[model samples]
Target: MANPNVKIWFFGGVNEIGGTKILIEDLGYDVCVFLDFGKSFSVEKQYYSYPNIPRSLDELIRINATPDASKMPVLQGLYTQSEITKLSQQKLLELEKSNQFKEEQESNIDAIVISHAHSDHYQYISLINRNIPIHISECGYNILKIRKWIERPSLTNNLFLLNVHTFKTGQSIHVGSLKIEPVHVDHSIPASYGFIIHTSGGTVVYTGDFRFHGHNPFLTYQFHDKILENEPIDVLLTEATHVTKSILSNEDEIGRKLQQAISATERLVIADFSDTDFDRFRSYYNTAKELGRSLVVTLRQSLILGALNICEGLATPNILKDETIKILIPKREDPTKPVTGERLSSWQKIYYQHLGAEVKGSVQSEDLWMPFKEMLAKMGTPPEEKLISHAQMLNKSREYVLCPSFNTIGDLQQVKPAAGSVYILSTSEPFDEEREIQFEKLLNWLELYGIPMLHVHVSGHVHP
Candidate 1:
C-alpha cells in the first residue's frame, strides 16, 4: 500500500464540467494540498429568477450545495471530491453564522492555485474563506474582481480574502515544497493557464481545461521545451475535452464555416451564447455585421463591451455602439411578476442605455426590475400579441444572442421554442468528452423542437 500522504487524487472535473477537486499529499512533510474545489451542475440544480426565465447550459449541473453521499456518474470513484463539494455547500448555507470556514481550511490544504475564471474553475474557490491565500494569474484576478461585483457582495464578504497573486505567463512561484510554474496558453478565454507542479518526487503538468484548435502546436512546443528545461515529468494531467479525432477544425476554419452557415440563413440570426465567451460571441456579432445585417444582442452580453476595461475582452467600440444592435432588458413594466435585484453599472449601464435596450432582468438593474413588475408587470395572462410586439422581438430572425443549449426539462417559459430553432450552436468541437455526450443530450432536445442545424457554430479556442 502506498503512503496516504504521497497520493494525488483528482476528486472532481476529471472528465466532467464541475466538481474539480485535486488533492496532493506528501506524507514525508505531513502535508496535503487541494488543487481546485469546483462543483458540477445538473438540470435539476438550476436557479431561476422566475420560472419564465430561459434556462442556460450552465444550469444543467447539479449545483453542489452540500457535501453528500450522492455520486456523479462521471465522478463516481472520486469520493473525496463528492464529500468536499457537499461539505462546501453546507458551509455556504451556514456561512451566515460564523467565520470558521477560514480557520477550517488549514486542515489539509497548503495553497490553491487557480488556472482561470470559468465558472467551473473559480466559483468553488469563491466558497473558500479569507485566510487561505490563492495564487492565480493577473487575468484570473481581474475576472474574480468582476465576478464579485457581479455576484452578491454581502454573501461573499470575506471574498476580499481572495488574496489573488498574479503570476506572469511563464513565471514560477514557490509555496513550501510545491513549486508551480504558470504558462500562458490559449483556451476559449485568454489568460487561461496550464500549470507544471514540481515536488520532491517528480513533476506533473496539469492542463486545467484547455482547447488546442489553431494555436495548439504552440502548446506542444511549450510542452517539449518545458520537458527539456526541467527534469522529466511523471504525469501529464491533460484535459481530454476533444481527445477524439473529431476536434479537427481550428478556430479560424470553424469561424469561416459558421460564417458560411450564417450566410445561408436569411432572417436575422439570433444566437444564445455565454456572454463571458466574448470571442465566439463577438465572432457571431462580427459575422452579423459583415453580412450587412444588424446583429442584435441582449443587455447581458452587451455588458461585456464596457468590461474590456477589466481585461482583454472582445467588445469593440464600433461593434459596441452599432445602431442596428438592439439589447434586451426586462420589460420596463412588470411584463410578468415583480423582480428584485441590484443594478450593476459604472459604464455598462450608460453604454446599454445609449444603445437603447435596458428594460430590466440582468445582472445589473435586477433591483430596478422590481419596479418593472408594477410598471410593466403583466396583471393576468400576457397581453395580446400586439402588446407583446411592443417589446421589440426579432423581426424575421436577423437578431441573435447565443443562449443556453438545452431545454428546461420541465421548468418555466412554456414556449420552449421546440428546442432547435431558438438556440444557435457553434461549429466548434464539443468542450470536452463529457460535453460531447452532453451536447448529444441537447441535440436530442433540438430533435424534439426540430431545431435544424444543431451543430452550426465555431470554436473560439485556438489550435496549432
Candidate 2:
C-alpha cells in the first residue's frame, strides 16, 4: 500500500472568531506550510488584559499565545528551534547531554501565506520564527511596512519578523509539492486574498475573510469564478464571521445614511471608522467632496494613506495632492503642555522622517515639527481657503468631516461639536464583553458632548 500523500492539522482559529492556524503537510515532499498564524482578537480577555501582560516571551507562552503544538512531537519541525528550546527545557538538557544542543538552529516551517493584515488574521505572525519565508500581496506588505513605522515600539519583532516576498493577485506560488494561487478578494482592508492550493491528495480552497458587498464586489465574484473553474474541490475552509445573519447594511446603504446624516446636521460632523478600511474612507472622502467639505485626518491616517499611495496597486485617496483632505499634525506634549520639536520621542521622529521622506529624501527636524498648514505649504499644497485649524473647523462647523480614532478622541473636546452636530459611528459595534466596556466609555463621552449618534456601518465579512 502507498503511504498517505498529505496530512492536514488545525492549530488555532477554530470554533472562534480569529487566530486561525492551519498546517498542511506535503508528506510526499517532506515539507509543510501554514495558511495563517493569527492571534485571537479576544487575547486580552482570554489571557492578558491591558496593563497586565507578561514581561517576557517565556511568560507569554506559559500563559497564552503559545500554540498547543509546541509540546507535540509531530509538530517539532513546524515550530522554530528557539521556540521549541524555550518550550522544552527537559528536552534541551537531553540534547545538551547528547552534545547536540550546540547544533545550528533553523525553521522547519516552509512558508507562511497571510490572508490579510487584520490583527485577528495576521497580528500573531510576529510569533512565528523569522527564518520562515512569508508570502503576501504587495499592498499587504506595504501596509505592514508602513505600520512598522509611525507606531511606537514597532508592530514586528525578532520572533515573528517577516521576510516578506510579495505576489500579485492570481499569481501562482510553488512551495515544495504544493502549488498556491492567491485570488484577490474585497474586504475591509486592502489586499485581502483567498487561496487555492493544489495538493497531491486533492485540491483545497481556503477563503480568507472576504465580502462581496464592498466597493469592489467584482473582485469577490472573480474569486468565485476562479474557484468554480477548479471543478472538484476536495476541501473548503471558509470564514463565517457573520454566520448568524443579522440584518446588515452594505457599503452603498451606509453611504446613503452618511449623506443624509451630513445633510441633516447643522454643526460639525465627525465620522469614526477603522483607519485601515479604505472603502469607508473613500465613502466619507467622496461625501465630503460632494458637500464642499474637507476630510480631516490625523498624522497617522495621513501616513497610512501616503504609504498606500506609494504602494503600486492598492487604490487609495490622494491625501497629499487632494485639496479635499487635510491633516491634523499631533503636537509633541509635556504633561498636557505642547513641547518643542527637539523633545520629540523616537517614534515621533520616525513619523516626521516618514512625512519628509514622502515629500523628498531629506529629513530635517524643522520640516518634522512644522505645523500641518506649514507642512502642506512645503509640500506645494495650495493654501487652505477652507480646511485649516481646529478653530477654523469651529468657525465653519459644517464644512468638514473629522476622522478621529479612538485614541485621538480627546481632540473632540477641543473641536467641540455644536448642538445640531452628528457623530457618525461608521465602525463596528462592540460585540465582545470586554470591547463593550470600551464602547460604554465612548458613549459616555458622546452623551457628555450632547452629540446625536448615527450607526451607519457595513460588515466586511460575508454572511453565512
Candidate 3:
C-alpha cells in the first residue's frame, strides 16, 4: 500500500501558470487541495476582440465577474484566449470527471484555504460547492464579496458559500491530520497570506503571493526559519513569479530604480504603479518627494487608500505639500461625494507652505501635505472623456493592481514606448506556447524603440 500519510498529486502551477491542483492523500482520505484555478487571458480576447468582447457563457458558472452583454467591451472572468475560453467549461468538466477536484460525497475533505482575493486564486473557489469549509484572509473575503458592486450576485454566489470562514494573520487550526497556519505577507492586495501545513511527512509551506518590501518581509523569513528549525523539512512550496533571468528584481530594488528615474526625468514625472500595494504607493510618493515631484491619483484611489488604512493597524501614509510631496486625486463627480479636490487642496496648501517647495523651484521639505488637490480643479469638466496619458511612469494601464490589465495579446502589442521610456513587467511569462505568441508581439513592439524591459518581480508560489 502507498504511504498512508503521503500527499501526492500533480502540482499544477509547477508546469504552467494556472490550474494549481494539489492532492493531499492523508491515510487514503484523498483530499485534493486546490490553490488556484485561473487562466491568463489570450492576446486575442484582450486585444484582437476589442469593441466586441466574447465571454464564454459556460465559463460564467465556473467564475464570477459577470460581463454586461449589453455593454460593449466588458470582460468578465479571468483573462484567457478566445480558444481557451471555449475550452474552459469543457476542461473543468474533464477535471471533475477525472476526480481532479472535490465531489459531493467526500464531505470529509477538511477545508479550502484561499490566500488573497485575486480571481486567479479565489474565483474558482466560488464555483466549488460552497458547502466545503472555505478559509481565507479577511481582506480577500471582503473583496470577493464586494463583487456584487461590479458583477451580478448570483453569477458568483453558490450554495457552498454559506460555510465560508475567515482567518487572520498567524492564526492556525487543525483539519483532519493537517494543521494550517495562515501567515500574512505583502502583495498588491492588502491581505495576502502564506500557509504552513504541519503533517507527518514534515512541515510544508505554501506562500501564495508575497514580497519582502512591505513592513514585514523579514518577518516572513523568520517564520519560515523558525518552523523549519523545529520541524522536519519535506516540501517547501513557493511561487517563482520572478524566477526569470535578471528580468525580475525584488521590490526594494524596484523602489530604488523608481527614485532614480523620477530624479532623472525633468518632466512632470508621472509615476504609475499599483495603487493597492500600500508599500508601492508609499514608495512612489517618497520617490517623487525626493525628486521634487508631487504624487497624485484619482479620487477612487484616495478612497481605497483610506479603506486600506482602516483594515490594517497602520496610519495613512502622509503627503507633504509644503515639503513638496503631494498626493492628488481628481474632483468628485457630484457635489455630495464624500471626498473631493477643493477640500483636499486647502489642507494641502498648509503643507505647501510648510514644504516651501510649493513655491516652485524651492527646496523640498517634509511635513506640509496635500491630498486630491488637482481633482478639485477639474470639477467642471464635461461628461465626454477620453483615456490618453503620455506619462513615462504609468503602470501598464491597469485599473486595479490585482486584475488582468489588457484583454488580449493584440492589446499588449499596441503599447509602444516613445524613444526613451521603460516597461517593467513584474510577473512570470505565459506558461503555454499559444499565450507566448502575444509576448512575441509585445517584444516586436519593444524592439522598435530598443526599449529596455525587465521583469522586476518576485515569486508568489513555491517551486517543487
lDDT, candidates in the order shown: 0.49, 0.69, 0.46
Q: Return the TM-score for each candidate structure.
A: 0.63, 0.83, 0.57
Best by lDDT: 2
- C-alpha displacement of 66 in model 3, angstroms? 18
Ranking by lDDT: 2, 1, 3
Residue lDDT tens for model 1, 1-464: 13333568665666555556676665555545556655444322344233333232222233433232234322222222212233332233344234343443332355677776666665556445444567877656655544443333332122434446678666787777677887766666656777787766677677776665543447545755676687676777666544553545665665676677677665434365555565565566667667765555444444443343345433253334345454444444332432222453423343333433333444333343232222122111121211111134443444443333223222113334432344455545454455577567766765676566535543533323
Cα RMSDs of all predictions? 9.8, 7.4, 13.3
lDDT of 2 by residue, 388-427 (tens): 5566566787788889865735766666677777888887
lDDT of 3 by residue, 1-464 (tens): 13456654442456444445454545533343444443324322333233344344445423322222223221112222122222332243343334434333334335667777765556544444434677776656545433422222232222122346778875775676577777776666778777777765556677776665454566567656656664655666776665563323455776787766545433333233444566666666565556555454433344344445445553445322122222332222222222322443333333233322222223222221111223222221212111112231234322211111333233223333344454556445667665688678767766675654555444443322
Candidate 2 weakest ten by summed lDDT? 152-161
TM-score for model 2?
A: 0.83
TM-score, cand. 3 vs. native: 0.57
Report how far residue 38 has shifted in candidate 3, in Å: 4.5
Error of 2 at 195 (Å): 0.1
